[model samples]
Target: MMSVCGYRWYPEYTVEEQYRDFNQRQYICTVRVFPDYPGAEKPIHWSYGLGVTVDMAVQDAAYSMLTIMRARHALLQNSELCYVPASQSGEEGYISGVYFDSSMEDPLLQSTVEMLENRDRDARALRMELYATRARLWTALTQLAPVVQTGYGEMEMLNPVRTHLPAHVDWPAIGGVTPLRGPLLPPVRGPRPHPCPYGSQGS
Candidate 1:
């Protein structure tokens, strides 16, 4: 089961955006394309290109999208046709050649499996804290102004506790010590469900 019987096919993409930080006139372009597989929860590959003109950016993006599509198609159909945007040399500006990578057990780009698991754990903790905070607010309001009418024939004004109040204060976890993950996806690429030649670690 550890050995791959055949190569799996998946789309690859890259997206990039470039702009001059000091220039207000520069435009930023984002291009995105994918296989559009139905019911796919994983992300699609993309590339970004920054250029002085809109045409330049669009041209690069289109070329990149085509390059990835052709590569995948060739691998899947076992065709002799192959697209190598640049030479194998890892030069600064040249396109790096594409090749098959079989180490699918590795972590996704910018993220690790362990980190993702920890995020889930942290999310559960934060949720519990949120519920605790809500409960405290309800209790405080009840005590301040119970089910009674004021002399003016209106509910008395209750100074509810501040929203910033801690649900379960843990000094050790305050500040940047234990930053909340919130709803952020890991800053890493996840393994493809089906292996692709671009650099799939597993099938």
Candidate 2:
């Protein structure tokens, strides 16, 4: 394919091995083609394949890449054909000197883009609803503040127990004693007189 396309560079291959057990192993091969010519502006074309041996994996990967290139008309049998740059083609699917069918209108890419758009729309809607809800709550609180204050004032004026209560109470000084700070307890009445020593006459 490179020779027909007037490319002098060779395709690079990388292999990796996955050992499932002592007797079971899987090999994966990746083939990448880089632009070697000076005036050729092309992105790297790559493909992957899996097999039981390194040679088999490499062959599989190479075959898959060639198949893709053939489908895209990237490989030309006649060297006399003029090459077209991807930029001049005005199509995103065009790479190197050929148009790739998969690059344009791919179902996976379309679906992914649609999914992201929907997610973004939902997020924007949620944020708008949150802002509106917050604004309504703030308005309700602002409108209710004066009514609440007036009701509290009326209750304070009508309650006689509250009116007679002292604003503050001073704790009596006790030697080496500290006064506890909390809700005040009612003052205790004077201690009751001791009972008579003798029992009641009726008893």
Candidate 3:
């Protein structure tokens, strides 16, 4: 059986210039759970972030996760978010671990911490929290362990705050390197050429 959830985060996606035409969009990214016969609506969608302040991005991330609950994990509706959003530059990160062992009385439990420290598939950081077990949430949260893919990266247990990005020695046009205002409409491709502002053809 497969399960999935939707999450969102405003990564510190730096730009050479924060352009004038930069319009805020309502993002409705979708995800899926295999072996689950959910239709299109199964994926999450929300507009609360359209033109919303940066402060609301974390709430939007939670909403995105809830849209998944409305489809898959109905029990999580009562569960508070383990983490909220934090900001550094253009990157908005999530606040996890505060409630990590919140559900464990002997908070120093080894197995639980090991789970938190371990890496999920693709080596993405994993946010492990021992959510309080309830009749409603018992079966659900456990099953959710393997399936939740997070956009707000996990706290690296060793050095959680180490800042780095995709190692780029000299990759052209990487990490918002493009001139921000270059084009509003996407480029058209064909045998014939389109003219640029200098009266020269082709980009």
Highest lDDT: give the candidate number. 2
Model 3 residue 21 distance off true place after TM-score fit, in angstroms: 7.7
Candidate with more favorable, higher lDDT: 1 or 2: 2
For 128-154, candidate 1 gives per-residue lDDT tens digits of 465466557556655544333334323
> Which candidate wins on TM-score?
2
Give per-candidate clash totals. 13, 0, 3
For model 1, the run of ten residues with the poorest summed lDDT: 1-10
Residue 23 lDDT, candidate 3, scale 0-100: 22
* Global lDDT of each candidate: 0.38, 0.47, 0.29
Model 1: lDDT equals: 0.38
Across 1-203, the per-residue lDDT of candidate 3 in tens digits comes to 11223332222221121111112122222222223243533333332221122222333334433333343443443444322211111223332221133255345645554454342211122211211222224345334433433423332221113123354632233222323434444444664211332233345
TM-score for all models, in order of appearance: 0.28, 0.34, 0.22
- Residue 149 shift from truth in candidate 3, angstroms: 47
* Segments of candidate 2 deviating more than 4 angstroms: 38-43, 74-203
Compose the digit string of candidate 2's lDDT tens values, residues 54-162: 6556765665566455444534523332222121122433211233333344576655545544554454355346546645654664455456557644422221231
Candidate 3 Cα misplacement greater than 4 A, ranges = 1-18, 21-104, 110-183, 186-203
